[model samples]
Target: MTLDFDQICALLPHAYPFVLIDRAVEVVPGQSITALKNVTGTEPFVQGHFPRRALMPGVLMIEAAAQACCLMMLAGHPSPKPLYALGRVERFRFRSPVRPGDQLVVTAKADKVVSTAAIAEVVCRVGEVEVASGRLSFGQVGSA
Candidate 1:
């Protein structure tokens, strides 16, 4: 399945400036998702992150990847959406700087899922070059 900007917004709780994923190109319910984020010079972080050289922060890249994983996990859920929280991030590595005009393609695959949590492997790329990659653990909100 594919998701547009509005659809992405509906699946996520984040708002403008924080909403990272622009669109989901592909999605496999309860399995994986491939999403996109178009980096631009207009992003608020560019001004303060580096006034002279704008680079997308590694943390934000992880955030984007995590969001993609959240989408994948949420795809199979029923209505009255369950909240998802970042439980942990592991083995995150930044391979290159992501700059303005770069189209970030992020892919996330569910590694494992239990009654209260889920683990996913995620990666972000600019074309064929990998910009960031990591594993993320998400906890189901209000679950123990």
Candidate 2:
């Protein structure tokens, strides 16, 4: 099954410009997820990233991965999904530059999950090139 924009909005607390991924192509509850992001020249950041050359910021790739990880973490939860905030990033590597018109395929697989925290292995790729890979950790946003 796939999650469209509206369904993604329902499960996530993000809105336009902030919500990175465009579609959830595959989801396996707490185990893993794969999403897509189609970069465009009209994206807000593109105009300013560079006047002559525009490339996707590495930081945003990581953010996209984190968001995908959160979706993987949330898919298995009961109704009224809990909110999770990125807590840590580890062993991340950027392999290539992402540019507008590229489609980023982000896949996140859960490493560990508990009541308050979860960890995931995430990778983002543009066709045959791996753009970024990392491990991300998340914690429930409102929990104490």
TM-score of each: 0.95, 0.94
Q: Which lDDT tens digits does candidate 2 get at residues 92-131?
A: 9999999988999999999998987899999899998988
Task: State model 1's lDDT.
Answer: 0.89
lDDT of 1 by residue, 1-144 (tens): 988899889888778989999999999977899999999999999998899999999999999998888788776577767778999999999999999999999999889988668899998999999989999999878521
Which runs of model 2 end up more than 4 angstroms from their true locations? Answer: none
After superposing candidate 1 on the true structure, give the runs of residues whose Cα lies further than 4 Å from its correct spot. Answer: 142-144
Model 1 lDDT at residue 82: 72
Against the reference, the lDDT scores of all candidates come to 0.89, 0.87
- Candidate 2 residue 45 C-alpha distance from true site, Å: 0.7
